[model samples]
Every structure is written in C-alpha cells, then in structure tokens.
Target: TPLRKWEDVERTVSLAAKELPVTDMHTHLFSADFKEQLLWGVDELLIYHYLTAEYFRYSELSYDDFWKYSKQQQAELIWQELFVKRSPVSEAASGVLTAFRRLGLDTSSRDINIYREAWKNRTASEQIDKVLAAARVKEVVMTNDPLDRSEREVWLHQGNTDTRFLGALRIDALLLNWTVASAELAAMGYQVEGEWNDGVSGEVRRFLKEWSAKVGALYIAASLPGDVRFGGRDHLTAMLEEAVIPVCLELGLPLGLMIGVRRQVNPSLKLAGDMSMKADLQLLEAVAVSHPDLQLLITVLARENQHELTVLSRKFRNITLFGCWWFLHTESMIQELTRFRTELLGFSYIPQHSDCRVLEQLINKWEHSRTVISEVLVSKYKRVYESGWLLSEEDIVRDLNEWFGGRFAVVRQNAAKTKVR
Candidate 1:
C-alpha cells in the first residue's frame, strides 16, 4: 500500500526498523558450542567491560581490588554502586535493566539474586533463543581467532553447532604483533617465521586459508591504531600487502578494518582500557588505490574521522563503511552518524554492527539501534515524500533491507569470485 500520509510513513519506517532482522557483521558472541567461552546471564551482563568502565567512574574501588573479586562479587559491587547508590540511568546500566525486563525478571525489586533466579532454569540453548528473538537478530558474525587456544580448541575439535553464527577471521594479532602470533603459529606446526619473505608470506597465507575454510570465514578482520599506513616499518602494512589481501582475493572475503583503536591506554581497565584516535585516511586510500577489486569493510572509532571516512566511501566502490564501533555505539552517535551517513552516501553504507560481547546484549544493542535508525528513516522519507516523491511501504521495506543486511552481502564477497574453500 502507498504511504500517502506523514503518519503512515512514520508507522511504516518504525515497524520495518523494529521487525527487521539485523545482520550483525561483528560480535564477540559465540554459539552454545563454545561452552564457557560464551558469556551470558545477569552477572556476566553487569560485569561487561562497558559497565566496569562506568563502575570505576563513580566508585572508590581500586583496580587491584576489583580484579581480586569473583565475577559474582564484581557484579554485586557494580549493582550496588551503579544501580543502587545511583539510578540505573546510564546507557550500560539501562541495557542491563532492558535485558532484565525482556527476560521477565522483576527489575522493580532491585535485587541482584532475583535476576539470577530468573536465569537459573534457563539452559544455554534457551538463552540463545530468547535473546536472539528479543533482539530480532537473524544472523551474527562471530570474531573467530585461530591463535586463541580455547576458541581454537572449540573450532578444530568440538566444531560450531549453531549455523546462525558465521565467522570473521581476526588477524590483528597476526598483522600488528607478528612475533607473538608467529611463535604460536610455529607451535601449531605452521611453518611461519618472524621475517618477511615470500616463503613466510606463503606459509601465513596457507594458515589463513586453512583456518578460513575451517571456520567458513566470511571476511578477514583487524583492529589497528590511528598511525597505520602503507609502505611502513610495521608488519601490519606488510601482512596486508602480502598475505592478508592476497588470501582475501583467493578466498572471496573482504578485509574488515576497524581502525583507530589505541589498545590498553589504561592498563588497569584491561579490555575497557583501549581508546580511539583519528586514523590517517590515506592508509585506506592507498589500499583502495592498489587493489580496486578487493572489497574493504571499514569503520572508524574516533568521531574526528567519520566525515572523512564517509567522503572516502564516496570515492571508492571497493570501500564500504560499517558500524559506529566502540565509543561511537551510543544512541546520540548512532543518530548523528546514521543521519549524515544517509544524507551523504544514500543507502550505500551498512548502518551499524552490534559489537556485542554477551548473548543478552543483542537485546539492548539492537533495541536502541532500531529506535535510532527508524527515526532517521522516517525523517528521510518525510523529506522526499513532501517533495512529491510519493513514498510507499515497499520503498521503506526495500531500503531497510539494504540498510540492515543486503548491503553487507554485496560489500563482503561480491568482488572476489571464489568461496573460502
């Protein structure tokens, strides 16, 4: 039916955005097959890096003291500090409440054990189902690291049971810290060495190819610093030029570059310790110039780099910007990013990735994202509608499809001809 009225267009956009099953291109989420590696439940949600970072902002707890406590004790401390002493109003705290309400837990009771009791009888499989359903996420790509011993054991030995989870080969360690990654690769019986040579490249490529096939990797991924560049001293640039890009071309996978991450700025915070910087855009321009056919999935962590990233996307069909990654995943950032990303790129960009580390995070992440995206769509539709373009329900659905999932497929494997096998 035609969306003749402004109200009708608003309804259409909201419904489409809400019901659309998101294709989360990057998540630290694992299937139930990962066993203990898969983090879920209320305690896990409370102690997540984001909340832990927030917990430190107000509490007088020392990093050493926090580290000494168990996950349960940490969660209880976070609950008392972040939720009880203050309001559960911060986005991270709000996410926990959102997940609780969706899971049918009585958040009004304000007790941590009540939340735990709700999750008591629920098995892993049930948790996955309920969370995915609540999030309306049809597919999620897991960050698969072959060098990580525990995850490696699961992939090579136990095997992944959930078809809903696809793999993206994480190569930051391989690219940035080759000495450490190479030693592990050598230990695993891959003939990889620290020196950069044709033989070394071939061995690294062979390892990537083997693992890409093992996990059916949809793409290769890396998180790099703002200072990343081509023709550099670092192994990162060399690995991309030699093994990473070549293997990507061979296996029909894109390189998802999550740039500008300055790892461990506050060493005490551990995973939450990282920060972002304005990456030199020339790095991407150089790679895009060199390999026109190699699809590049890009996301910039710093707000300073967003406009330049969007403009770069304009120049290269090979480059597709995705997600408001890391610090930029909040509601305001999503609103600002999605608005300009739409105004500048039209429907060419992939809107957002969940980047979720826990199972239930999918609920709050997508819920917040869908709300923000729907507003953007409605306003865009209204502008064209008032211009006598005469929008329809079909138009909103079609664009929403591309915005959420369709564009990912096109950008990911369309350039390369072969499957990873």
Candidate 2:
C-alpha cells in the first residue's frame, strides 16, 4: 500500500535517512596508522578551518601572531572569542555544539579543558569507530597524495591500514602546479621533470600506476582552481589528455574533480585562508562531452554553481555531481542543493561528501546532512504520493542506499573487476 498518511511518509523518510550508511566520497581523513593526521577532540573541532575564518573577524590577533601560537593556544583563543565572548550562533560554531551533543558530552559546559580531557581518554581507533557508528558512515574515501612523503611512506610500508579508509589518488600537485610538483617528484626518484613532453607524461603514468596498484584507489582526483579549463592546448591540459585521463581509463577509475578552490586568499592563515569562487561550468561540460567513455564525479565549491552543475549532470550521463563542498556545506545550502538536485536529476546525484579532515566531524556533518536530506525526501515523497504514485519501504531503502554509498560500492566493484582482467 502507498504511504497515504503524512506521518507514515515522514517517519519512513526520516528513518531511512538516519539509518542509511554513508560512504564519504571525499575527505582528507586518514587511518589509525596516521593518528597524528586525524583531527578530533573539541579543540580541533572548534578551530576547524570554517571557524578559523570566522575567528579572524572577531580576533584582534594578526595572522603572524596567530600562527605563532600552538594548536592548543589557538583553540583556546577561538573558544574565548567565538563562544564565550559572543554567541555561538553561526553554523560552524553550532556544529561543534552539535558534535558534542551527539557524542554524549555536556554541551552546557563552556570548559574546553574538560572536553579535552574526555577526548584524550579515547584511543584514535576507538574514537574512529564511535564517530563512524554515530555518523552511520560505512566507509571513508581518503584523499591520498603520493607526493607527500609522509603519506607515501605509509602507503609503501603499511599499504591500506584500515578497511574503512578507502583511497583516492589526489593528483592536484602534479596536474595543477607542475613546477613545484616536478621538483618534488624528482626528489621522490621519479624521472619526470613536469614537462608536457613524452618523458614527463610516461613518468606521470608510471607514478599513477604504482600508486593505484598500491592503494587500489577507487578514483583519481585533483582539486582545481575556478578558472580551470578543459579545451586548452596548454601543458596541463596536454598532461590531462596524455597521462591522467588515459591512466584512469586504463585502470577503470573515475576522475573526481573538486573544482573552484581559490587557494590562500590570505596567505598567512594557510589552509584556513582558502576560499571559493564560481567556476567555469563550460570547462566541465567540455570534459564530459569530450570523454564520453570516462566517468567523472564533480563537486563545485561555489553555491551559485549548484543549479548549473545539476543542469549539466542532467545533460551528461557520464557526469555525476556530488556534494556541497566546504563553504557550501551549511544546512540551508544542502537543503537547497538536495532539493534542486532531486527536482532535476532525481536521486541520480550524490547529495553529500563529508570532506572532513577530522574523524569526529563525520558525526555532525552526516547528522546535519541526513536531517536536511530527510526533510527534502519527505516533501518530495509527499508530493509524489499526492500525485497517486506509490513508493514502498523497499523503494525508499534502495534509493537511500544508492544515495548513501551503494553506488560507490558498484563503482569500486567494477574497478576491481577491471583490475582482475
């Protein structure tokens, strides 16, 4: 029977959304082997990049002075200014509160020290399990950089340290800024000089092959600037065509393009200083059109690009628009994007990617996103039910699984088969 009652529809949708296990398609999160890389606890949560950006406006401290302080000191200052001095009304500030509340902690306590001590008692692995369980995250797709010596050593020695931490090869440095990447690649004993010539292209392919095999990377990804173009005759584009795309094609891996990160607007603040700008959708369109055989997973950083991206996804079968990234991760934006995506593309697009640098963030990120997703699904399902269409519990679960992470599983399975052949 159709879910005729509003209560039935709402309950069904909410439960599906909440219980659906998520596969975080993109994140900077690491495994237990790299415990130092895992950012958790209240201090890390409070001083996250989003809050850091907001902290600057209220802070009297200059960028240089702020950088001089230790992580603990920075978190203390942020807590004092952002939470204590003023109201924690903003989305980023409130997110910390949400995390605390979800984690069975005292949100009423403004004491950072208390929270820190509580967090310190939990081991990294235990916390990861707790956070994943809380987030209902099935697997976390990690952004692995082969160029980073620390990450490289881990991959070379430990391989994949955790089953939950799936790898994605991040080729941003090699593709976007070849000058620096060439120097780094050479230091790592790769013969590529970062030129667009055959020698460099071959070395790039070799590097990709090695890393892809080592980590069984699900995809090859790169974070591009807003101004990135596809049809260009430049070195970068040439490399993309000659090496990157071909390697992905050979490996049966999709290309995950995270476009529109305007790096370091305020140089002193480093990672926190990065911002977003509206990107050239035409470039994305061109890539999708040119590579009909290639599957591309794209997420633009700017909110304005959401509708256009959805429209593009509708037009191209190979292009899958996923996530409301960084600045666009707010509930309002997620609701807007998810609603627009469902209206235009049905449930074909992936609604969210945690992009969490910290493990615990998976908790609040998914919790907030799931609530918004449920709301959108309920409204959409209600409209469909009114139109005399019936959707079963099985149908809702199927859709939720696909949206959550089942699609990713299929993609990975296909890649695995291709590798076997």
Top candidate on lDDT is 1
lDDT of 1 by residue, 251-342 (tens): 88898899999999999999889988889988899999998889999999999999999999999999999998978999899999999999
In model 2, what are the clashing residue pairs, if there are any? none
Sequence-dependent TM-score of model 1:
0.98
- The C-alpha stretches of model 2 lying farther than 4 A from their native spots are 1-4, 410-420
Scored by TM-score, the top model is 1
Ten contiguous residues minimizing lDDT sum, candidate 1: 412-421
The local lDDT score (0 to 100) that residue 341 gets in candidate 1 is 98
CA lDDT scores, all candidates in order:
0.89, 0.84
Model 2, span 1-421: residue lDDT tens? 6666768777988998999888999998998987577777777887798888889988988888998988899999999999999989887888888888888888888888888877887888889888888888989988889888888878778667689988899999877788888888888788986346789889889888888878778899998888978777886688789998888888888888898989988887788989899898877888788987778889999888887888888898778888989888998899888998999988787889989987788888889999999999889888888887888888889888888987666655544444424
lDDT of 2: 0.84
